[model samples]
Target: MTLKICVAQLNYCVGDMPGNAQKIIDAARAAYADGARLLVTPELAICGYAAEDLFLRASFIEACDDAVNRVARELAGLKGLTVIVGTPTHGNTGRGDEAAGGLRTKSMAVQQRHNAARVLREGEVIATYAKRELPNYQVFDERRYFTPGQGICVFEAGEGESAVRVGLLICEDAWFEEPARLTKEAGAELLVVINASPFHVGKGNEREVMMQNRVRATGLPLIYAHLVGGQDEIVFEGRSFALQADATLAGRAPGFKENMFQAQVERAQAAIKIIATTEPERGDDAELWDALVLGVRDYLGKNGFPGAILGLSGGIDSALVLALAVDALGADKVRTVMMPSPYTADISWIDAREMAHRLQVRYDEISIVPEFDAFKASLAGEFKGLPEDTTEENIQARIRGVFLMALSNKFGSIVLTTGNKSEMATGYCTLYGDMAGGFAVIKDLLKT
Candidate 1:
């Protein structure tokens, strides 16, 4: 018998309870229509990942709890379909023991919150799995927010003769062997891992290698459902995939796209095998470009930014940022402003205008020479004959920044800064000048 699993690679907005719940319901409906027995969404799909300080509020957690139940209720009565959603949940182990027909032997203690996965079926939360490993790495601060979970959640999927034991694991849980091995030891023939892992260059390749290692070690077919969106600084590229127990590639969804990918797994001789499916191919540059586009689009769209405004210098960084903004939000929604300083070449304005025209976005010209002169004249009295250096150069950049910010204030447009990694790393960029924007388009990108 074959079991069809749906991996929902979706973009969810942070703190938007109704919208995120509706997204989950819609995805569940589509997956159900496709004959999927189980639908797996990314980690923290309900409330979005890296919620940061919002997790600290009880009201926020309550809203998330209500949203989780709402999704369960909405997805109820769908025959033979189970949806697994990620959320920040209270780790009331005492209540869980009581629900299991045992008296609450433990005393009342401090509140414990967990990064958890909920298994929903028949309009109810059947089982819940808390992430055992709390990653405290570079960008992750899970240790500060959530307490580590203790046990594994292994439940059954499908019914009758086609039923298979499925296990749940959160993002960092799969990195260690204990969680996967524990689930496998508990009779889980299939492992389903949900993740909101942030994207760095070559991260997808690293994920593939990790998945292969886990499959080889556990001898259980695995399904990976990853988030696909940008949340502030991090971008989650959805490369949802499945691997056979023997570590063979099965099916893979494309990166940087919202998809309800279906993986068909069948029971083989003493092991489960994920049937090989079509894997979409994309070049490295294509993948990187898409990541930027998706990141810009999600950051703007989800945050309710009407459009975007950026300083379109003739330099490669600003030009690339303009192209990315146009591609992500469409040309009509993007606006470019050329704030030419006294030092700015005439050819700079020409290039900026030509690129804006080619892209067909709204273009405006604002000369910052007057502002630069004003700033310099005002500060000359205090300078006391000190020779001008980068102070003058920064004044020009700050003038451009002030004009771009003024445009942003006049129109409800997000200011996208065009600072690449190379300039930022060596402190070659201005802080209050070029860096004064709502979003940094390519902060992580190298010059090369």
Candidate 2:
């Protein structure tokens, strides 16, 4: 069987069903007009990915179902196309028609999020598959929302370049081996996945590399459709691609843009073309910078912080933190405070002041020696036998921390901690001193 499939990698709005549905309709129409026999869309293209609490609302899900039904109605007469699109499918028990028994046993009982891909052929629902492997780790809580899908759905389409059987999996399923193994066992000639995988710099190539391994392992051509757009603190860069049964990249769509393209698979090796493709020209370093830029911007913006305040120690960590904050939120939105102690280097002060000025950020300095001396006098009796080791060193830091926190509170700005993993791991940081802040910028990094 020869099949030509189009994956519509679209950008979706979190709560804008009407707007998202229009885009889906337009893309479907365009792909059909371009002679695509199969149309695939990214995960939750209709309802949007990570629609967090929105999924918990029956009205919101009803909107999604209406959108899917509308799209099916709009494309009802497309005689030769099979469209696989992601939508929040509703079920009384959140279970599909297919199951060994009505009982969703032990492990299946944990999380009950119902994420599904609806396959529409000539304007009617053919089959649906619930997502397995609901990621519950950091940033993902599908287990709390969606129940594991009951079974895999494979079907045959005769409208492709040639006819073939294909299997469908949602985002996480393609990452696991059993889903693909079962797909093969079910005699699926092709495997297609819908994902809302976010980009964090070098993540695009990582997805592709994994797909290559998955293709090699399954002996099947793979089609991956990913979401594209900036959502909250995360941006989904849809670098959608396809691999031949042997794991050769057959076609790819661009990132950071709405795109759609088709892959034709035939019993005999189809004449795949190497059309000059222009990707987002993103290098590892550039991607990392972009991700960081987005991360800082979204993290603050979504959390409702008006601006950021940081203690500019003139060290490498502080300098970098200042730059990132200024870049993410405007320079006018960033403020830096330099607290100089007796042990502080002058060059540190000079560098930090200059950088903050260059970035057009408001900068100020507060001397802490007077207060440090007072603290030492007050703690003299408490530290009678204690020979000042790092204790004295930390008092200076604590004073500065207090100064920064005071400035932050007075200005209604958030304190941004500048400690990196190296300092954090070695305990070079003083809690309630350097470690005190509303936001710890580099908290998740490992000590290098």
Model number with the top lDDT: 1
Q: Write the per-residue lDDT of candidate 2 for residues 68-178, one digit (tens) a residue.
A: 888888889888678787988667543443455766644443323488988888779899888987898868888777778869889876554577788998888988898
Query: How many clashes does the backbone of model 2 have?
Result: 8
* TM-score of candidate 1 to 2 decimals: 0.93
Over 4 Å off, model 1: 93-108, 380-388
| TM-scores for every candidate against the unseen true structure | 0.93, 0.72
Whole-model lDDT per candidate: 0.88, 0.78
**Model 2 TM:** 0.72
lDDT for each residue of candidate 1 in 175-232, tens digit (9 for 90 to 100):
9999999899998989999998998778887998898899889888888899999988
Span of ten consecutive residues with least summed lDDT in model 2: 270-279
RMSD of each: 3.2, 5.8
